[model samples]
Target: MDVKVQKNLLCLSREAAEFGPFDAILELEGEPDALWFYREHVSRGVPCIWRGAVAHWPAVSKWSNDYLRETVGSKEVSVAITPNGYADAVREDLNRFVMPHDQLMPVSQLLDVIERKEDFPGICYLQRQNSNFMEDFAELWKDTDLDIAWASKAFGAQPDAVNLWIGDERAVTSMHKDHYENLYCVVRGEKHFILLPPTDRPLIPHMKYASARYQLDLASREFSVVDEKDHGVIPWIPLDPQKPDLNRWPQYRHAHPLRCTLKAGDMLFLPSMWYHHVSQSQGAIAVNYWYDMAFDMRYAYFQCMDAITDTVAEGNCCAVGDHDIEDEQELSTGKT
Candidate 1:
């Protein structure tokens, strides 16, 4: 991008952080009224945590490792296996965005892999997002709510999907945005989230990479990235928030990141289009409801911003003249 455009983008990010209501995530002692939730948080696209909101959930206490092993141990379910813990992330080594190899295995065996009680060739994660909890683990639905009552009422519809996540610390969810408003509840252990607002889109680098998948070689007990020529290229964020490369992505320096940890029984209201990267404690379990976001003016404005960013990134737009240098200097200096 042109230097002037980059500086302006940086300025926009700074202003967002400065003008935003809370520097850190706001925590609610309890659930708010459905009208308040929709009016304040959902409509405004703000994130908040409801402390111990799901504490009364039966799964929070009953879904122990032994109990899980006893309840659904013999059931065959899909598991994501990767050489490294990252399931769906940019594999810089291969210059491709690789997805984990989906393997079907018994729940008991998967638990053994998670606990390190058995030798496994790859890291294992049960992270199927296709409403796997409802589809496969129907036995466990009795332990948790089918849908958050307040959330459904606020969204004016039931969740499109309810996902179950069971993974260890090694499994990491790469930074990305979703199109659905999310209600994430931690049932066991802890979940760490690094969040960024959608307004920081210009500061975050989005690159196109070929799609690939990890395939394990049973004979060699190894994994390799196999390109999916038919899938074509995918747009993804390459920058890692934990260890950012400032030299390549200098605009990210101006971006603001909010960090929050969700303990067992905690729930986070993640607004649509917000960027989030996640990591979890060993054997952490979570269930999240995805409600489709409204295609309102907010989304329309974001789409416009995204188009402008793409144009700026491609250097298709003309640079600001020398007369604008003073304004650029002011932006860089954090001056009005």
Candidate 2:
């Protein structure tokens, strides 16, 4: 379609309306697709995601040469990829964090390992603050294929202990949003992301802020975010962030979902407090930058803010880095 690029423009009410429902993007393929695009042979409809992204994926691959031009099965298409299977397979090879072997190993020498992957395994984590990241964060800025200079403008202060996720199609996360404004970007394959505005967040089921703590305890692998807990599955419950269950906490339902997708070279401007969910379609891979309010909030000056910060970033890890503030103060302080 007609993808328009605007500079220094404010999203008018109509232009900003894309946030209410989910959206999808397609075709922007590139080189990496060659390495990761294995012949699935299974022809199926797309997926049940709200929005999907597919930018810069490789059009061809060395391995794909064998099955080039071959339709999936009896049909004209080519692969039979099971989304759940794909998600499981991708989680196999990714390092929890792939922080450049170049900084530690020089680029030319390690190019092979970087270019050789059957599928993309995703990476996710929580880390402490690094001051150097603000001034001239080389990796995030110098290397990003997108407008890092423009993208970096949206940080208040960098967060100390914030959640970070990166990966390929195999790195599919369940559709969920936390009490945080997210910065989602696609460096590799196209990244499909969906978000819920604060008004819709209550529809997302949540647990006591303290009980789930990253809800899916990665340490134990108890990834039950919604519903109630059964023996092991943690029982999936639909938590409406806007209208919470009084029986449970009686104060949930306030959150909403406002979602979208980001192709390679694309960036998302998430206001604090917005809830989001994402899935990578086909050969898409991506990463995200999440900021908690304890973060530096100066970037508010750039993102079309008519007044002060309207959406406060709040959720599970609300005041993780605030050494001086007590838990009580953490809950009380939100975007003003």
Candidate 3:
């Protein structure tokens, strides 16, 4: 099939129009039953918001600055530091996909950086995802459940990792997808997410960039991109959803994006493989459960789609770092 036809079928505008305003997103009033939740949302890979789902968790009420300082203050934790707050994102100027420089700092010091009480050179974000909650912050585990009951039931497995996120307002998570079904719960402040469905993979351009990491010189307080010679080229999406350069990535105009904000006590069910970019209110604190996704038929289909996308990209003579192809026409006039 032609690319246009494929794009149209992928977007499914006729069905979306029929759904009307609901096409924006689905919101759940409260926690859902396992069977119904799996059948309606999880099975179909649909995203939803569960308002006040974890409102009753003790952390939501007791996790004030003083409380956290008194509890886990002196504990040294891993913190991702970046000068531009764009950790694990494409550094266009350097032509590389750069990772943040991770440093070990006391929780109290990290909080001070986030609160602007300490004048740190780079943005500090405590975003270690290696089950940090169950490890470094184990003392605070009494405040919240180890696992989300309904979500664990729906996924038929416990979370592979539970991560705690505390970051400055400038710390931004670049557009990326994960292989795990994610349940992100905001415990303090708010988080804004820009989500794009996986079907838009073709429209969303991907380029291979050299892998690098930001390294800060402690004495100079300056950051430098250090290339990881062994890591090779990393495929990443270069477009920034917040300020998309439509002229360069004009095909992205055909993609549709959903925007949502999750306040404290709210939980977001972000399905596996859904591309998302996230930013947060200053001192935003969140916990996310990563459940391993089943490598079932859905995953198989996505792999097939991904292979087809690569084939199309190759046929259009799209280079490694540049995706724009003049010979390729616009597919759909949906939304940017």
- What lDDT tens digits, residue by residue, belong to model 3 across residues 1-336? 445444544455334434433358788887799999888878878899989999999999999988999999999999999999988999998899999999999999998888889878999888888999998888899999999998888888899999999986899999999999999999999999999877767668888999999999989989998999899999999999999987777767767788999999999999899899999998899999999988899899888877877777767743222233222324335432
lDDT of 2 by residue, 1-336 (tens): 000101111122223334433333222333223112211100110112212222332321211212221321121211112223221111112211111111222222122222343221213211112322233223333223332222234333444322223223443444443433444555445555555433332223432121121122325533322222332222122333333454553322223233445555554545454444456644343444544532234334323332211121222322111231233223233311
lDDT of 1 by residue, 66-177 (tens): 9999999999999999998998999987889999999899999999999999889999999999999989998898999999999999989999999999999999999999
Screening candidate 3 with a backbone cut-off below 3 angstroms (N, C-alpha, C), the clashing residue pairs are none
Candidate 2: C-alpha lDDT: 0.30
Candidate 3 ranges beyond 4 A from true positions: 1-22, 317-336
Considering every candidate listed, which one attains the maximal lDDT?
1
Q: What TM-score, over all chains together, does every model reach? A: 0.93, 0.35, 0.90
Count of residue pairs whose backbone atoms collide, per candidate: 0, 56, 0
Against the true structure, candidate 3 reaches a TM-score of 0.90
Candidate that scores best on TM-score:
1
Which ten-residue region of model 1 has the weakest summed lDDT? 316-325
CA shift at 156, candidate 2, in angstroms? 4.3
User: Residue 188 deviation, candidate 2, in Å?
Assistant: 2.0
Q: Give the TM-score of candidate 1.
A: 0.93
For TM-score, candidate 1 versus 3, the one ahead is: 1
Model 1 Cα RMSD, Å?
3.1
Model 2 — TM-score against the truth?
0.35
Q: Which 10 residues in a row give candidate 3 its minimum summed lDDT?
A: 319-328
